[model samples]
Target: MRCLWDCWPMRLTIKSGIAALLLSTGLFGAASAAPAQVADMPPAGEGPRGTSQAVLGAERYDAIGYAVPYDGGANPGAISAAHPTLPIGSFAEVTAIDSGKTILVVIAEQGLATPDRIIALSPGALQLLGRPEAAALGVRVRRVNPLGADQQALRDGRPASARIDAPAVLLAALRKRLPAPPRSVSTAMPRPPRASNAAVNLGAGAGYPVPGRAAAPSVRPATSRQGTGFFVQVAALSNGQRASDLANSLAGSVMAGGGLYRVRLGPFPDQASADRARADAVQRGFGDARIIHE
Candidate 1:
């Protein structure tokens, strides 16, 4: 009968074969897990942990690095690329650092096998750059908006113009974050119609006057005080016309002194008489009226 335990040489051969089988299986599983060396970019708007963390090459607007070329889809002449962090539908101009050959490619998807390579371009894109799809080629990628002039340029088979300078881009970004300007207070706004009520009932003489209403035909003339007794001084004003109008209405006098037109009802017998006169002046809308003596 044959022994189940075979000779040492045969046993070693079987052991090696089993080991090789396990190794190949492990390799296949790892390959299947992250196949194509990259995963399709997570759909946009995924939570931070999901997809929308940010761009990988975002540190530099103009990224300079090597690109791995791969076939994107059926169209061999498709202008597309996969950037680890660029927005999926955005456009970029990829240029060969050495040859300076550039081609505008839309970022169709995302994911990069590693951070060492800045981007993964379609074989068609590399072809446009005049580089071999299999070899390493350093590139310069400038981000662009497809809605901008780049879209039309691509359609015309022309290159996109370089964007505004760094200072201009910085200024634009700052402007967007700045607070809105304060609205101007309008000087041309319409004024309220003048008060039609008698100012004697109100306080001050506000705007607008009906012509005949202010004529006081029975008003008394002011008695001149020869630097004696107290007087009820209605107002001290700069405008002669305004002072004169107030004096005429209150049966007072306008005396000009020290750059002011003084309106006063004067020559009262005593302090009590002056006090009564002051109260009358207040009732007639001279709220600032007070007793004064010469």
Candidate 2:
């Protein structure tokens, strides 16, 4: 037979046999059993020992930067706002960045400001901030007081409570000095039966007399308190007689103060109820009837 090294096939077969023998003897097993290469690893740093625990961007937050008007009209001139996160009855301090004018505002309603805005202020706050056109910008806000659990609980489904309560508290302090509600005001007016066309007898070339609707009783205007709770100021007047006449016509209630009589209907259970009363008062010819807070 040809020599193993001289014959190509025999030479290759002898080499493979020797390699298998070495592997079975465990001579090169250490190399074969070594850990995988970087290419075969999980990732650059994916193992249990490789991960980092530090959080990224933990301090990122949106700061209050501007103010919009709280347009609910319940407490027009009150220092109040609709906040995105603050619970009702919570109080916040607002500072105008440019003017450095700071004021306290109560959380009255839940709302998110525009991405570029922060809180919505009441007319009074807006005016105090010197932003009377319904909106202000470039302001800073900080929480001054958090709502207590009990009051926040009471204001859970009732957002108006905060707006109403602030003014109510102030009103309570001044109640003893305030004038009492007017009594015995008659809002009654004569209501004639509608004249039927048939009763008038339609005749050719004959003009029939048409009676106009009765005029609404006149009343004085009064300024409303800036608080929450539902009421409609149908009329306000310094003239007691006119105020009494209007109150009597509407058959509602009256409050007199500061030489002015206010024909009002309240304290309704909710804003919707008060709004409906406002509409009815307006329809009844109190042209300036509007929703107001007690």
Top TM-score: which candidate number?
Answer: 1
The window of 10 residues in a row where model 1 has the poorest summed lDDT is 44-53
Alpha-carbon runs more than 4 Å astray in model 2: 1-62, 146-294
Q: Model 2 scores what on Cα lDDT?
A: 0.47
RMSD of 2: 24.4
Given candidate 2, what's the lDDT at residue 45? Answer: 18
lDDT of each: 0.51, 0.47
Residues 1-294 of candidate 1 have per-residue lDDT tens digits of 554668887799899988889788786356568745442322222211111122344542455566655444224356666665665556776655454455677765443433336666655666666664334455556664444566665433344444322233333333333332212212232212222211121224332221111223222233343356787777654345666687777777765432234577876989999999999888878666767676
Per residue, candidate 2 scores C-alpha lDDT tens digits across 1-294 of 657476889889999999999889987577879887744222221211111111232322224355655442344566676666655556565655445455556665545424445666666666766666633445545554334442343234222122211133322333233222212111231222322111010112211111112112243343242234787877543344555556656665556432234566766879889888888876877655677655
